[model samples]
Target chain A: MGKLVYLYGIIPEGHDINELWDPEKSAIEGEDLPYVEDFGGLAAVVTKVSEDEFGETAMEENSNNTAWIQEKAFHHHEALLELQRHTTVLPMKFGTIFESVESLKQMIEEKEEHLQHTLQTLEGKEEWNVKAYINPKTFYERVAEANENVKAKREEIEQMSKGRQYLETKKLDKFIEEEMFKDQEKKAEEMYDRLAGYSEDSERKKNWKKDVTGREDEMALNSAFLVVSEDLESFLDQIREMEKEKEEDGWLIEATGPWPAYHFATMEE
Target chain B: MPIEQSTRSDSIVDVLELVLDKGVVIAGDIRVNIADVELLTIKIRLIVASVDKAKEIGMDWWESDPFLNSQAARKEVEDENRELKERLEKLENSMASDRTQIGEDNK
Candidate 1:
């Protein structure tokens, strides 16, 4: 069997690959160095891999291993990041392997138009991720203090008999929990709307469970925004404004940015 | 306004999810087998997007996943209820034991 080519991403035609640095002697180690396969005006940044290691069975086995996936995925991302510094890159998903370079070229040739359109749309723009988390305990306390209904329920519980008080308190806790969840969702939506105003495109990412996040605060909002290079400063300013406005409510905003347009690169179906 | 930048250096997890979720997929005739029985095939396509974006593109698996949806919250509440029931039972048992001991001492 012929060696497989691991495709990283596509870049526009005439991009000076050599100016970026020699792919043969890059610091992105532990894998084959990437090279460009030009198909007309577009080029695919790819690296060669032995079929034994990257074949179906081997890939399936490796997918189950977190360390292997992380290592390979990191290298793949590093290669794309490096290429992106020199030219706009349309990052491919990890493990996009072709049986051979000839087949890879043919595939690129077939998809050339769509690839060019995507690259043109994504040029000079980067993806920014903004995640908002709120300290649940403090947030609930603040909400309860601000809500009249919760205060009334608490007062009623205080006046009840011991048995009734215990049950009533439990009921109140459940009600509070439900209300807190609703409030969280509302806040997340509002934050997304505000941030979306500043972005060309925005996406609401799935909120990570507390255990998955490994954080004390609950994830209120997880989103990615596609911002133009010139609008990035304004986007950051908006985020800062939001932080000031929501800090009293125990909501925290975290942003990471100028990343490859991972969330905005979906090809039109 | 204090804005915090994400302190994560190893963004591999995100990248892994991204590459697997979004990107072009080109099928090829590559398969692994044992004794002429095909075991695996390399046909992968990924498109990573937010819930709304995925839905716009007709890919919304996360919405229906039980572990990632309201079912998980319900499970947590059920677990909490079970623990509370156990605690309530213990409290009632201890209260009964104390009353019986008091009656015996009075007699």
Candidate 2:
């Protein structure tokens, strides 16, 4: 069986691999950890795998198996994150492989300029993910108390005949749902805007469904911010403040990272 | 403000989604075959973004997916229920009119 190189990511020139990852502590089960390969000034962190397991057919089969994908993908991510702690890294997409180390080096040489630019731009920044969830029942209750339209509708329904009252109640429920969705969207926008002030760049992420998050609260905001290393603390502090301010509205904020500039490391043209 | 550092294990889902959805693709020939026939050709496409970062780079197929978009699925169910309710109302109205006509004929 032929051996292939499974590429993980690119690190800055002259970065020491041993300094980045401790083999004894960070080694993944059932997978070999990555080692750096110098290609001129840039280096690629890679691992060796048998062609039988990593070849097209085997990879296709494994991709379809959720369990296999999860295990392998997790290991792949861990290696990159480990490297990220030591130096700037341009993480490769999962499953990138080369026929030989020579070919991998050749590809790196060709893309050297683009790689250098990406590394330079992403050097001091880290990516942070902020997710905001709101308890729907509590949110609606607060809205009903504050909203004049809902208040007036409730009073109108109280004076109506029985049949009319039932129909009006249904209409009121629909109205409340519509208002709730609008309010959630508005709040998400406001939260994103406030956080954007602390970061070098920010992007609004697509809100996840309740099932994906496995949470009952509605996901009001999903966003990623590329913050400089110096601003990291202040950013976290502001998020805490926002959480406190919105607690009465049933808002919960979760922020994760100081991670590799995964969102900001696009290859320069 | 308390910031949570994403431990390697804690962000597996985020990492998986990122690596699959956004990353550089460097194509190479790594096909394996039998007896001069090509069986498999590997395409090396890598996505290196974290979950939310992937969304930033336009890797949001889950957003439009019916299974993942609970709100959209709920909307579809609501539409179907409305149609069924309208049909039931029509059936009840016709039945009531028939009874009225029968009473008038008897009188």
DockQ of 2: 0.17
Backbone clashes in candidate 2 total 5
Candidate 2 per-residue lDDT, tens place, A218-245, comes to: 7889888988888888988889989989
Please estimate how well model 1 matches the true structure, expressed as its whole-model Cα lDDT: 0.64
Best by lDDT: 2
Q: Report the lDDT tens digits of candidate 1 across residue range B9-93.
A: 3233344445555322333334322110000101011111123544565434333431123223333334334544544444335
Which stretches of candidate 1 lie above 4 Å from their native place?
A: A22-32, A148-169, B1-10, B22-107
Q: Any residue pairs clashing in model 1, and if so which? A: B21-B46, B21-B47, B21-B48, B22-B46, B22-B47, B22-B48
Output the lDDT of residue B15, model 2. 57
Per candidate, native contacts kept equal 0.33, 0.41
lDDT of 2 at A250: 88
Q: What is the lDDT of residue A77 in candidate 2?
A: 66
| Model 2: residue A15 alpha-carbon error in angstroms | 2.3
Question: For residue B66, what is the lDDT in candidate 1?
Answer: 17
Instruction: Looking only at chain A, give the TM-score of model 1 against the true structure.
Output: 0.88
How close is chain B to the truth by TM-score, in each candidate? 0.19, 0.19
What TM-score does model 2 achieve against the real structure?
A: 0.70
